[model samples]
Target: MDSLSEQQQQASEKPIINITGEKVALGPIRRDQVPLFYRWANDFNVLRTLHIPRPSTFEENLAFFERDVEDEKRRTVVHFTVYDRASLTPIGRVDLEEINHRDRRAEFGIEIGEPDYRGRGYGTEATRLMLDYAFTGLGLHNIGLYTWEYNLAAQAVYKKAGFREVGRRRQAKFMGGKLWDIIYMDCLSTEFVSPVLSKIMVPDEVRS
Candidate 1:
């Protein structure tokens, strides 16, 4: 291969941590991936696990991408694409949303959009990776999330990552022919725990 081509190939092969764990890696959401984003957004199964209950149009999804980027610039939101490490292919996404900088907190959510990638514990690891970034990297004190009451599996993943249920909005969402509560949970910075710390560290005044 030509020298420039070789470097490009090497870059693709190298694991970019961005945010990482054993089975998955998180990295910046690229504009070109908006098409994939739209596909996931329209997937019934995908939206079932997310806050948005209705299917989104291509234009709406595109607008969301643009808006997320804009909010990221203002430091109120951040988005990351999840990748399977073995194949280096994008599988889903996780995001820190509605970030309250003044309160040192943010809301979290994640999805494993690929059917094949589900039920493999990838979501749990990705959650921890994001928590690591939130508590240490961003210096946020609290990270919160809400899951559909029926999404017990997702809640298990959050619990494994040290989150505890703080409250619930009863019968807040009607879906799949019934109503479900919105289970609210949060983890404090002091409570955040992750193996990613072995690879990355952010210090405070005591360490300085």
Candidate 2:
């Protein structure tokens, strides 16, 4: 039997959406990249909305990279580090987590760790690129995600990427000694087939 590598599959197939003038690239996380990711995960601004544990040691972060990324079964839970093409550096990561092939769906998760990287539209662009890869490259039916209501910026990014708010879980998050609502959003392949999103996402230079 012949098996297609992930890169091969992505290159040969069509994607559900392609935001113009932007591209999303992925590769195995390097040892050097681990420290970068660790720094991002530890930053209070970036982790504020994440259900992550306390700041991780470099060793702990390395373990996490091994588990969620290296051990990921390519069939489900594909992970990728988001990179800025212009600057040629990893800025963040986006993934299709908890994928269910039987159901033909998966949940989306993303984070741009560098505080200097936030609010410049890279998050949305990275997301659009991933959505295209998930729907078109992987032949999936649905992609969805959950975000806290307080994360208005992230919610806006999701909305710009074609994810529509479909439901909400009241008081679903308890972090920093407080409860917050979790909003669920999703977009169908048909709903995201158009190129309407280009207007909402434009990239900025990655901070040095």
User: In candidate 1, where is summed lDDT lowest over 10 consecutive residues?
Assistant: 198-207
Writing each residue's lDDT as its tens digit, candidate 1 over 1-208 gives 8999997677655535586678998988876678888888878877777766686788998898999999999999989989998787889989999898889999998988888888788888888988988887888999998888999889899998889999999999887799999999999988765578635574454753
lDDT score at residue 68, model 1, on the 0-100 scale = 91
Top model by TM-score, which number?
1
All candidates: TM-score: 0.85, 0.77
lDDT measured at residue 66 in model 2 versus the true structure, 0 to 100: 79
| lDDT tens digits by residue: candidate 2, 61-89 | 88988787545756668777776655556
Identify the runs in model 1 with alpha carbons over 4 angstroms from their true place.
1-17, 51-53, 202-208
Error of 1 at 35 (Å): 1.3
